[model samples]
Target: MTESAFINITELTREFKNKTALEQITLSIQEGELFGLVGPDGAGKTTLLRILAGLLQITAGQVVAAGYDLNKEPEEIKPHIGYMAQEFSLYEKLSVVENLMFFADLYNVDVKEQEDRIQKLLSFAGLTEFKNRRAAHLSGGMQKKLALATTLLHEPPLLLLDEPTTGVDPISRREFWNILTDLHLNGTTIIVSTPYMDEADRCSRVGLMYQGELVICDSPVNIRNLLDGDLVKITTSDWQEAHTVLAPLAGVKEIQTYGEALHILVDSGKTRLPQLTRALKEHNLAVDEARTASPRMEEAFISLIRKMDQVN
Candidate 1:
């Protein structure tokens, strides 16, 4: 491992049969850094996390994590990291506190200190009141919190979470992030893969994966600036027709639709706003709303993936 890198990967790759899952994934995450992995479906996010957690084999390359070579000492690295899978199992028969005690015992927590630790974790995960509630009886959000609390039983220095917030409600997701923020503040390095762009924006840095490759990795602001053009958001009753007209017009380079609003990338928002409006009017389309808008993470992510598709 590098002197300061908590998790160091060099030219890592994973293969299943003939399909390449991860290709030359080289990354070094420093201590206390909150790294977010973002990409479309089947982008190798889970593959990379599984390799780091010692749950999957790397077909090629090197990984040094927690001061151990993953290839040679997979078991040695396990105690240094807390890995939570998307479908991490919780005994549906056990209550929240029972589940915590089970993992604490498994981790070999000191008999005398286990009670104190479990209590604190229950409070931390906001499950103190639900201590007696069975895992299966808990809501999707609460169950996720319980799973997270279980992973922290050993108080590992690093956390590898794979879509911990999927299927969770918005409020619960926010609360989950709050717990993560607390962990990050206390100097625990976290590498989380999420599809939500807003979640990616919360990380100190983000790595975008695509087609079994780490396509881009940088700060959220830097990634958004990757698209060197302005964005214009427009809403029209005739969005289908408007799309057909605006897609081929001058200055428009890319377009995406979100519900009834259309987001268009152009050479310059100031120059294209009037040009686009005029073109829409010429086609007799009613522009419900149109304005120059700030570029967002989703736009940047899609723009990067689109460029990658073109290259391939």
Candidate 2:
């Protein structure tokens, strides 16, 4: 591992009974960097995070966090890292302020420093006005923020968040990301996992996990660049005929219908679009509109998964 890396995992593997959860995963997360783990459900993201937090034992390989071996020095690692699970895990009946105080006491924070930390966290989470509100009475987004505040109360160097914005509204998700950005700016190393591809773009680096294995690890731009060929969106009067005509085309690799439009990936560029249109016209398919479409991160993710499946 490089000196700058705060978390290092080498050939890490984990299993529950006869089922493997993580498979020979290796990665390095830099100090003060915001890294994201992107995967579908049952992709082993939570398993990896639990192993790094020392909450779960690894079946093989090694994990090092903040200069301590995860298996050997969990106590040493615990004080330096904070973990927030998918479920906020806040006490439902406790007010936001009380919840924060409870965790501060659990982390053994000094009484003198606790008040200032709690105040700052409340302000940062936009919960200052709701400090006296019971967690059970708060909205889903507010509850999530309160949970984040509790996790951050002890001022850990590293924060591990699992689907922090999963059920949050768009505005609340934006606010939550802003808080994370602020934490990163203050030199906190953050590792977050989400099933949403758009959320992965928020990280400095991303690891794409599938079926307990990391299939791709790179910056979002680099991952999108891995997608080859050109994509075209075709909208026509006769959708079925257009799809049938395009599916058997010479250069077309894939065709997927999205609502009223068909997204076609071809080996060539706009030149192929004209030929496609011409072919559709010959088949009595009334073309309404056809244009080139940019390859998005979601498309890249799907392509990567398909490629991995082919290899397996």
Candidate 3:
């Protein structure tokens, strides 16, 4: 482990009776970094987060979080990390402030400071107005904010959030991330698992998990650069026929359909642009737009997964 690594894992593996959830995974995260974990479902994102939160036992390997060895001192590590689950456990009958008070007592927040801390968190989470409302009456977004607020009452330095914004509305998701940004700026180390590529783009660094393995780990810029070819956006009158015509062409790596448009991954956009245009014309297909486009996180992720699938 590096001197500055706040979390480190080596040859980590987890298994159920019939399957391996994580396999030989190794990673290191520094203090105050916002690290995003992204992957398809059943890719072990939740298992990893659960392990970090001291909720699950590691079947193998070393994990050190917040200066405590998870294997040797799981209980000791619990107090220093704030963990939020995908389906957060909230007391349905409890009011917003009541829920916060419940968790404050559970986390053993200082008696004298609890009131001040709860008040601050209620405002920070935009729930001050709804403090007296029952948890069952809150909006989905409001409930998520309440869950996050409860997690923050103790103000742990590290947070393990499992898909915190998964089912939230776009506006609420944005608001939640803004709160996370403020916390990050205040020097908290956050590890969040999200399925949204745009959310992954906002992280300081991202780890792409696939079939229980960490396939790629890097800054968003670097991960996007991993796309082996350029992207050419082509819009056609009949995208169905255009797709068939472009499938067999040389230099074309992959063809992704987007309603009426097709994003073609080619060896070189300059070389394939005219070739694609000419071929479509020969097939009597009308082209409305054709241009080289930048590769985005979605395309890069799909391309990388395709390659991995092919190899496997």
lDDT of each: 0.93, 0.89, 0.94
Instruction: Kindly indicate the candidate among 1 and 3 with the higher TM-score.
Output: 1
Tens-digit lDDT track of model 2 for 213-275: 998899989988877898888999978878988899888987777777888888876789999
Model 2, stretches more than 4 Å misplaced?
Answer: 1-4, 236-241, 257-260, 286-289
Residue pairs whose backbone atoms clash in candidate 3: none
Give the Å error, residue 275, model 3.
2.2
CA RMSD per model (angstroms):
1.2, 1.8, 1.4
Clashes of 1: 0
Candidate 2, pairs of clashing residues:
none
The parts of candidate 3 lying over 4 Å away from their true place are 1-3
Q: Per model, how many backbone clashes are there?
A: 0, 0, 0
TM-score of 3: 0.96
